[model samples]
Target: MNTNYHYMRFLVSPKTADALSLRQAIQNALVQTFGIVGGSIYLDILWVAEDGNEMVLRTTKEDSTKIVAAVTSASTPRISLQKESSFLPALGSTSVTLDEEDL
Candidate 1:
């Protein structure tokens, strides 16, 4: 199958200790929202910012919206799905900062 993956940036609150937990939370949220197969298959965390407050995720275009909704509904860590765009567009912006309220 041919899949087109896009990148999404999220502003995370109360930074997690490591990427593994972050990824797991996201996947768990996805599974809860979208079901086991859909949630576990298409998402991957491409990069986690040094501060751990930001994460760039790559997911199939078809699954993007579901992933965003899943993340937004997760309350414990409070995640905000910042933007959805192609890889280059997501990387093109020079300064991407999370506001205090977003956290």
Candidate 2:
């Protein structure tokens, strides 16, 4: 319900990255995109999947665009944005229909 913030979900490629790797990647991307200022931006990792391939991140609305751009721009250990929303609950909803294999 917080409109001042944005939530994002990213899925890691190869499905083998850990939380630390994801954090480092994001930080590196931010730094690469906007130098040290961007790298210092405040953000929070709300949740990381048990498999360590998916995570939910929280940041200010103004910084959301920068974050999305930074994350997607990174090449190594590819990171893809799965979802983004102003409403935190919206990120919890599944956009894809689950198959038996996923269940």
Candidate 3:
């Protein structure tokens, strides 16, 4: 096994009624922050149920630390990370466990 991996998926719940906008803001932050990284990376933002108030994000990382730092810093009073995970393919990753203790 190469033991190399990259992928992250998380949910964001904003305090406001505009989920889609919140998602866009976060996506912009990620791209702006990580676009300079050398390795090819990908980001996907999904708005929950078209309500424009809840969303999920999937990111393929060249570096998890950078992504985490960017997201954490970009988060605002109206937006917060609900759940997230870092994957390592070299370890044969499977699923992300969102534990009660995570909160």
**Can you give the TM-score per candidate against the true fold?**
0.78, 0.81, 0.42
Which window of 10 residues has the lowest lDDT sum in candidate 1? Answer: 87-96
Span of ten consecutive residues with least summed lDDT in model 2: 13-22
- Clash count list over all predictions: 0, 0, 4
For 1-103, candidate 1 gives per-residue lDDT tens digits of 3448788888889876477888888888988888888687677787788888888888778778887889889886777977778663645476769999999
* Tens-place lDDT digits, model 2, residues 1-103: 3477889988877674477777788899999999997577878888888877888999988888888889888887677889998888888898688899998
Candidate 3 structure quality by residue, lDDT tens digits, 5-92? 3444434544444645654666666666667453234555533435444445455445555656666767462344444455323223
Off by over 4 Å in 2: 96-103
* True-vs-predicted CA distance for residue 102, candidate 3, Å: 23
Q: How many collisions between residues are there in candidate 2?
A: 0
lDDT of each: 0.79, 0.83, 0.51
What TM-score does structure 3 among the candidates reach? 0.42
| Local lDDT at 15 for model 1 | 79
